[model samples]
Target: MRRKSKCVLGIEGTAWNLSAAIVDQSRVIASAESSYHPVEGGLHPRAAAQHHATHMEQVIHDVLAKGKKNNAKISAVAFSIGPGFGPCLRTVATAARALSLSMNVPLIGVNHCIAHIEIGRWLCNVADPVILYVSGANSQVLSYRNGKYRIFGETLDIGIGNALDKFGRYAGLQHPGGPKIEEIARKAKCYMPLPYVVKGMDFSFSGLTTAAKDALAHAPLEDVCHSFQETAFAMLVEVTERALAHTGKKDILLAGGVGANSRLMEMLNTMCQDRSAKFFAPDKAYMKDNGAMIAYTGLLMLESGAVLSVEDSAVRPNYRPDEVEVTWR
Candidate 1:
């Protein structure tokens, strides 16, 4: 058999996004992403699954269309294996497996969180650093130590983004409320103070989010938004600083959707520079949920002969980033 450079088609249908990507050995050639329509309340699992089922095929087609435009053909298939809503993941997995079998290619399964970290490393090109993952469903400060990504700190109640979104919803904002809150916050003044909760290297946003919402009920909307942003950003900054101090790892990389916050990025950038430490965040495309990251991770894993079978495929809603077995290429 002739050996060929590794390429993988990555499919990621986690919570709200249905994404697909084609990655060659060197880089991502093409990608597609589709987000869930607005649900009245928070994530409605059945509705999310329905969205995935409806859009996943289109996402895959668009990804392949782009790849064909670039004359890139994948060698294998890879799908995010877990730490997401099971129904949504199953939709992607079914698509990936079907393609893999029909194309007579190997299939690789990737942990969504690990893929996030891997994409951060790929973009930042950092050797070792503390990684802060702040997304809709998770918040943690992690480091690769002792052969695994060790969690140094995490949320005690709700993830930062979740808390923010909940508060935004309570304020009569649209779904995926973080951006709406940030938009309102830009015009607001932070005259009122909010609590900043940072316990050791971990941070809590539930209290702050509650306080912000309550304040809005009695205070100006703009003021409440501004106060919320200031307090939440400060808490994140403090915890990040503490993680750096505790681990003695000056290098820090931010990943996931919350990493796109301008205020948060600016604060961390200044702090890192002042402390003579490095700080890195991926471009907006990589920061938000996408298939490119999964494709990139799958490319590496495929190159290392890490492939899986359909019978063994499963989605884990609670899969931790640190629990994945690492295989660096």
Candidate 2:
């Protein structure tokens, strides 16, 4: 008899978002997510983990219900097992283990960073491309070579999103600083001077952020936001352009929360146009941290015969994208 169709359920709780998604062979069937926003400072790992634990069950149930599937039909359970906060990663792992045991299905551990790249590739239908992964915690240029996604360039100090958030906090903006900064930057008519440091292919944002903060005392907020974004984005685009030239890749894929910024997208698009390369970025839903990417990537892993025993389902808080073996490709 022919085997039945398979569906994988993915859980994601790497940081502030608690998400669940169900995916079949072709696409994500359903996805649900709940995000925790700090009232004051940055995200607290313990508080974020507690939020995940509280909402994980409901989110999972909602996804399953939305997909119209029961536990009996699930072929595997996948969870992001690393490169995140310890408390949040552990919480998701525990939930994934329980679900795997209850359903008697295979368990898969996914690299959170790689999931972003895979989903972008899947969405754009690009075979091989230079990846610019930027988020609150990470900034790197990656390419697939020697059977793995290798990092060509990365942040030396702080990620771009974090830098923006810090600037926003200093400016008394809301929790997530990227969007607000982008909004105010639109009205900028003049640009201020800021530090632009790009060492070889790698870049540094700590110095630039400090300089931007200092400018806030004397310069208009709009000018500071504009200049800060321009300087930082120019550094990123420069590094990405260098990576493309070095790798001889004709396509560029932008993935991560920062990919949602219109100014960044415009800059990348212009650079790609000038360099005669293609640029691709997923929609907002897939660009940010979500369960759909996890579910889709997990489906690929499971199809490639990847199986994780409960004993080995422990989370890796410092998991790196290059450390994973790319069996699916």
Instruction: Indicate which candidate wins on TM-score.
Output: 2
| lDDT for model 2 | 0.91
For model 1, the stretches where C-alpha displacement exceeds 4 angstroms are: 1-4
| Model 1: colliding residue pairs | 83-316
Please tell me which predicted candidate would have the highest lDDT against the true structure.
Answer: 2
lDDT of 2 by residue, 129-149 (tens): 999999999999999998799
| Model 1 Cα lDDT, one tens digit per residue, 48-137 | 889988887788889888988987767889899888888888888888899999989998899898888888888888878788888888
Give each model's whole-structure lDDT: 0.84, 0.91
